[model samples]
Target chain A: MPAIEVEGLTVRYGDLVAVDRLDLRAEAGRILALLGPNGAGKTSTVETLEGYRRRAGGKVAVLGLDPARDHAALTRRVGVMLQRGGVYPGMGPAEALSLWAAFYPRPLDPAGLLERVGLSAVTRTPWRRLSGGEQQRLSLALALVGRPEVVFLDEPTAGVDVKGRQVIRSVIAELRDEGVCVVLTTHQLEEVERLADRVVIVDRGRVVADGTPAELVTRGAGRSIRFGAPAGIDVAGLAARLGAPVNEVDPGEYEVGAAASPATVAALTAWLAERDLPLADLRAGRERLEDVFLRLTATGGAGDGGQR
Target chain B: MSSSPAASARQPGATPPSAARQLTRALAAQTAAEARLTLRRGESVLLTLAIPVGLLVFFSVVHVLPLPAGVRRPVQFLAPGILALAVMSTAMVSLGIATGFERQYLVLKRLGSTPLGRPTLLAAKTLAVLAVEVLQVAVLSGVALALGWRPGGDPAAALGAVLLATAAFSGIGLTMAGTLRAEVTLAAANGLYLILLLVGGMVFPLSHLPGALADVARALPSAALSGALHASLTGGGPGGGVESWAVLAGWAVLAPVVAAFTFRWE
Candidate 1:
C-alpha cells in the first residue's frame, strides 16, 4: 500500500470550505511536493493528514490506518514539523530534543541529531535566543529524531539560510533514499525543482496541476524561441511564413511559439535576412514552473489571490 | 562508514522498545522537566513555597488576631490553614496559569501530536505538581516545628487530607487552564486564590465570618481541606464535617472529567 493516501477529502471551517474533495497519494521512497498560493488549502490539507484538525468528509490513511481514530498508533510511525511553536522559549535545543525523543520507542540520539543539523555548537542556547535559521534547523532535527516511516514538513526552508537549506535538502534526500515517504509544502520553486519527484499544485481548494517538474513545464505552452529585434516588424507576414503564432511581448522582444526544427530555423533566418532585421539575440526555452504557477493562481492580486 | 557500532546502531531499522517502556520514560522525562522549570521561575517559587512558609512563621510568632474559646496558641490555628493554602496555590493557581500559557504558545498542541498520549501528558503534569508539593510540605513543617508547634492528631489522616486537597485543586486548575485563554486564566486563578484565602478560612477562622458566608465557606473545597488538616494536626480527629469531605470528593471527581472533555490543545 502507499505510505500515505487520501480520497475525496473535504475540510470546512463553519461556512468556509478550506479543502474540497482533494485526493493525494505518496509512495515510499518518493518526495511529493504540494505547491499552492496562500489560502489555497495547503496547510488545511496537511493539518488534516497529521490529525491536528478534524476532517469534514472523506477518508485519510497513513500507513493503512485512519489518522484520527488510530492517532496514537499512527503517531508512532509518522513525524510532523509545524510552521511554528513547538519548542519552549527558555529550553535549550538538547533539552527539547531529548524530551521529544523520549516519546518514541527508538529515537536518534539528540546530540548526534543536533550535530547533523549544524546546531551542535549552539545546543545550549535557549530556543528564544537562537536565530530564525537555527530555530528552523532545530525544529527539523526534532522531527527526524523519531525515525518515522513517513514525515510531513510545512515550509521547511521558509526562514533558513543558504547553508541551512542545503542541510535540509540533503536530509530530505537521505530520508527518501531510506524508503521513508516524504510530503512537503514549500513556496521555493527552485527547491521544488531540485527535490520533488512529483508535484501537485493546488488553487482555490482544488488540484490545478499534478505531474513531475519536466512534465509540468513541457505540458502546456510548449517549446518556444524568443528573439530581440527592431520593434514593429511584420507580425502578419511572419505568421504566414512560420505557420505559428508569434507574439511581441515587449518592445523589440518577439517570441515564436513552436518547436525550433532545422527547417523552421532556416526559414526564420531567411525571413529575417530578407527584411535585413538584425537579430540581436535568440534562445529556445520552455515555460517555467513559476510562470505556470502564476498564470494558474493569479486572479487580480499579485500574491494574495486565493480562497482563504 | 560502517566501521563503528554506533554508526550501525543509528540506522533506520533499529527495533523500537516496547510502548509501555517508552510511555514510562516519556512520563518521567516530562515530569522532571516541568519540575525543573517551575523551580527555575522566581515568581513561581515565591508563590508556591515562600509565601506559605512566611505565613506559618509570622502567625506562630505574633498574636495578631483574637483567640477562639478553645484555641490557646495562634500557631495551633494557623499551621493547617497555611498548609491548605500552599496546596491551593501550587496545584490551582500556579499549575493552571502555567498550563494556560503553554497551550497559548502551542506547546501543549505540539506535544499532543507526538507519540505521547493526552492521558500520559496529564499524568506527567500531576506528578510534577506533587513533587513540588513535597518540598513545600517539608519547609513548612520545619518552620512550624521550630516555632514550638506540635501535631496532636492522626498523621495518616493528615496525609490523606493533603493528598485529597492536591487532587481537588489540581482538577480545578487543569480545568481552568484547558478552557480559558492564557491571560484570562492568569487573572482568574489569582483572583480565586485571593478570594479563597479570605473566605475559605485559610488565614482566618470560618467562625469569624457572618452566618451565611461562614456556611458557604465551610462547603468550599478550600475550607474542607483546611478543616480536615486542622482536625488531624490539632488532635481533633478529622475535624472536618461530612459535608467538607463530600465537597472535596465531588470536585476531585467532577473537575478533571469536565476538563478532559472540554480542553482545547491550541
Candidate 2:
C-alpha cells in the first residue's frame, strides 16, 4: 500500500460541491506536490486527509488508517503544518515547540529542532513579534518535532524569505531522505520543480495531471525555446524557416515550440542575422513546470488541456 | 499506487525523546501552561484576583449596602459574596474570554490536531482553573480574616460550594466561547459579568428588591453561588437557604453536560 491514498473522494459544503471524485496516491521516500488555482478544493481535500473536515463521499486513508475514523491514531504518525495561526501570540518559538513536543509518542528535541529550522536566533521572540519568514520556519519546526512518518505542509514557503525558503527546502529534503512521505500544497512552481519528485495538479476539484515533474513537463506541456527580441518580429517567417510554431508570448519576448531542436536554433539565429535583428537572448530545449501548471489550470483554458 | 512495498516501513532517523507522556505529565504540563498563561495576562489577573480584592476592600469601607438590621460587620457579608464573584471572574469571564480568542486564533484547532486531543485538553484546562481558584480562595480568605470576619461554617463545605460554582461557570463559559465569535464572546461575557455582579446578591440584599425580581435573582447562578457560599461560610444571609445548594448542584451537573455536547474544539 502507498503511504497515502484517496479514491473517488467527494467533499461538499452544503449545496456546493468543493472536491469532486478526486483520486490521489503517494508513497514513502518521495515528495508529492499538490497544486491548483484558488478555490479548487485543494484545501478541502487536504483538510479531509488531515481529519479536519468530513468527507462527503469516497475512501481516504493515510498509513492505511481512515483519517476521519482513526484520527487519534493517525495524528500521532502524521505531521500537519498549517499555513498560519497555530501558535499562541504570547508564546515564543522554543516555548511553543516544547509545549507541542509533549503530544506525540516520540518527539524530537525542541531546542535541536529550533536550530534545525534556523529558529535559534528567535527562540525567545514571541510568535506575533516574529517576522513572516520566522513564523513560517517555526511552523515547519513544530510539524517535524513529532518525528512523524508522513508530513503535510500547506504552502511551507508561501511568504518565506530566500534564506528561510532555503532552510525549509533543505529540511524537507532531509525528511524525504529519511524515507518519510512528504505531501505538500504550494503555488510555487519553481519550488515544486526543485523539490517535488511527483506533481499532482488539480483543477475544479479533479486531478487534471499526475506524474513525475519531468513527465509532466513533457506531457504535451512540451519543450520550448523562449527568448527576448524586438517587438513585432517576423514570427511567421521564423516558424517557416525553423519548421515550428513561433509566437510573441509577450511584447518583445518570443517562444519557439515543436521540440526546440538544435537545427531549429541554428536556422532561427541565421534568419535573425540575415535581417540584422540582434539575437538579444536565447535558451534552447528547456521546459518549465509553470507552463504545465498554467496550461492545466488556466481559467479560460478549461477542458481544452492545451496539449500539443 | 505502489503495492510493491510494505504499507509503511518505518525508516531510520534521529532518536528523539519518548513522547505522549503519561496522562499525569500531560495534565501537569498542560495545566502549568494554562495557569501560567491565565496569570500572565495582566487583564486576567486584574479581573480574577485584583478585582475581587478591590471589591471586598471597597464595599467593606464604603457602607453603601443596605445591611439588614442584625449584621455585625460589612466584611462578614462582603467577603463571601466577593469570593463568589472571584469564582465568576476566573471561570466565566477570564477563562471564557481567553478561550474565545484561542478558538479565533486557531489555537484550539491546532492543539486538537495533535494526540493531546479534545478530552485531555479540556481536562487540563479544568485542572488549571482549579489551581487558580485555590489562590483566589486563599487570598480572599486571608483578606477576610484580616477584616475581622469571623467564620462560623464549614470551610470544607465552602470549598465544595466553590467547586460546584466553578463547574457551572466553566461549562457556561465554554458554551459561549465555543459557539460564538471571539469578539461577540468578549462583549457578552463582560456584559454578563457586570449584570451578575449586581443581581448576584453580592453587595446588596436580594430581599431589598421588589418581590418578583428578588425571587428571579435568587434563582440565577450567581445568586445560587452566593447563597451556597454564605450558608457554608458566614452562616446565613438574605440569599442563603438549603435550596441554594440544590440549585447550584443542578447547574453543576447540567451546564457541563450541555457544554460537553455543544462545545466545538475549532
| TM-scores for the candidates | 0.89, 0.92
Each prediction's fraction of true contacts recovered: 0.53, 0.42
lDDT tens readout by residue for model 2, A1-308: 89999999999999899999999999998999999999988999999999999999999989999999999988788898898888888889988998887776566778777877888888989888999999999988888877788899999998889999998998888888778899999999999999999988888888888988888876663377888889999899889888889999999999887666667777888898899997778866545788777778888766744231
Tens-digit per-residue lDDT, B1-266, candidate 1 = 23222234456575667777878999999999888888877878999988888877887787896544588877778888898999999999989988988998788877877888888888888899999989888888888777777777777977888888888888788889999999999999999998888887777788788999988887778988988888777877323666777787787788777877888888
Tens digit per residue, CA lDDT, model 2, B1-266? 11211112223444634444455566677788899889988989999999899988887888887765578689988888898999998899888998998998888887877888787888888988989999998998899889888888787888888899999999889889988999998999999999888888787767787889878887778989988887778766556777888888988999888888888877
Superposed by TM-score, candidate 1 places the C-alpha of residue A218 at a distance from the truth, in angstroms, of 1.7
Tell me the lDDT of candidate 2.
Answer: 0.85
Kindly provide the TM-score of model 1 when superposed on the true structure, using C-alpha atoms.
Answer: 0.89
Task: Name the top DockQ candidate.
Answer: 1
Task: Assess candidate 1 and give its lDDT.
Answer: 0.83
Error of 2 at A127 (Å): 1.8
Best by lDDT: 2
